[model samples]
Target: MSARARRWPLVLLLGGTLLLSGCGLFGGDEEEDPPAELLKFKPSLQLRKAWSARVGDGSEHLRLGLSPATDGTLVYAAAHDGRVAAFEAGSGKRRWAAKTRLPLSGGPATDGELVVAGSSNGEVIALRAADGKRRWVGRVSSEVLAAPAIGGGLVLVRGVDGKLTALRQDDGSEAWFVQQSVPRLSVRGTGAPVIAGNVVLAGFDNGKVAAYEMSDGTLLWETLLTPPRGRTEVDRLVDINATIRVVGEDVYVVGYHGSVALLALESGQVLWARELSSYNEFALDFLNIYVSTETSEVVALSRRNGREAWRIATLLNRDVSGPAAWKNSVVVGDFEGYLHWFNAANGELQARMRAGSKRIALAPLVVGELLVAQSEDGKLYAFSERGKR
Candidate 1:
């Protein structure tokens, strides 16, 4: 990857003195080339704030994956301070809340039967969806950074140490665990395991995506999506921290400093690959794939052939979150708590709003006619179209 494609800012030394971050960490003078200022655009969609609630004491800007989740009826959210809560999907009324005191950081994934959340300390807890009662607690080998995948009567937790542990959904006992060889220097997060049919798919720090049989944990197929290269550890980084998306029998995988590729779900054959890098999550609809690139460029690619369709770079260098596909638009949050909506067909700015004062780090969730997003300070906001209510 070229320096321009680098996700993280490069530190440079000139004339025996390190360039201070404020002066030029962005590869130019900060004053002269600041993040693209939010521009004025005519409103095409009137964004309305529907309801807002708090989940817990907030993530304190740790960038944890405590996004809001839903099972078509209720919204589930977790906080870094060990608070998990469920709300009525439409009215935003609190259903139940629990205090696990385990530094909840990863989840709140629901299967409409059980709600599961993981901690920064490698602990997984499942709660009864009916009353928020604790059901079972399972242990893993590393910090669980992604939402646990629940399917086939099992909970698959993606560990930061490149391991995926399957626990029994009934009692939280270990069913199986698979550890992949990790690179010495890699990104800190892991892609959540995706369950499809009888197979569980996961990406690793070494830039490979593998599938395992859900029943017996047998290796089914593995494909190297990103091949590490260059001389330094940072240059060779190829962590696939982005969430893997599956549509029917096709799997979508993207890695940091690597390429985004579509693979055959059963045979691990590469169908199409595009040179795009993202550390954040992605959203897809029937025809297009939305991705937030490392430098905060929201891009749309043709889902069928991996061709570029559109890109919105007005928010570059702003630490933007991944894009979420809502009705006819793509929504993304930035470090400053602003959510920008773009036309799904042509990338035109449709609408923008400030959901909160703190950063919104996760892709917003879509439930019914409302769009839900969680900020760093544990604030959950649901937005609607002007006439959605």
Candidate 2:
């Protein structure tokens, strides 16, 4: 089989096993249970649409890492077909749009002046944020599946080959590079690096998280979030593909088929860990950390002790995005393009909205008070609290 043909099963498996595992051809004698119906609920809070726009053809068959990046005033987004656009955060008016004519698989990272994205051909294109002018293009070792991070005058990108490369922000020149051991069989996606103070934190397919010095690419510390277990390779597959979260002095991360762990930022010490499996980003407030599990359940746990607060499993098998906290509510998007809101204090359904007819592949971007979501069909919608300005 060609490489393209070989990738299809991996993509389907990462999306969810229900697509193939439940079939009678797989040798199960008993019939699988049907998915639960979505329950009807009364509206507890109101949400109003602020503005809407489009980028280009969004992720169709490929799981694109296209997400919106903001600089307080303008929101930047990208499509898989190499179209990157910027819009005013308040009005949703298009500021500028640019096309690289390449198949983009990752990015839309910006640090106010420069916006950088990665193409499937291993090229990183940088554009000016003011008018969408091309600035520079740099090459990497392989495909980049995560958004690049900018800090300490460097743009940090993590590739699917388990390599992290840092490029200078002004000229796209190579600053430093680091490589980690790549597992032979792992998930299809990568976690974008998070920059805090003078360090950059990233996760690997080997179920490890490492911190690097931002200025020189020095390895500060590495910790195994989940040690591989079981007998078979599939049974021992544990990848830390979820983005790491930094809150004050603590760092939080999750691994597939493994655990959610809280580590001390200063020494990479495990303070607490809870058995969980997730490949999505997480949100945090003062009291709890909100997460969307691999089985499509939304859960909240105490940040202080890693104790479970509440979990809502009504959206199982829907391929839900990670939770994003807004006001007193937590929001999550599903494959059917529906955005569900739950009260943060308790897991009560408060409101729901449909962004488009296609699936919502990424979490909603919270811009101040506005909630911005991008659907698979290339539609972008900005919403706000009903009564507020």
Per-candidate TM equals: 0.92, 0.92
Best by lDDT: 1
Q: Could you tell me which residue pairs clash in candidate 2? A: none
For residues 254-316, write the lDDT of model 1, one tens digit per residue: 888899889999899999999988888999988899999988899999999999999889997
The residue-by-residue lDDT of candidate 2 on 187-258, one tens digit each, is: 667889899999999999889999999989899999998899987665676888778999888999988889
Candidate 2 matches the true fold with a TM-score of: 0.92
lDDT at residue 16 of model 1 (Cα atoms)? 35
Please list the Cα RMSD from the true structure of every candidate, rounded to 1 decimal place. 4.8, 4.3
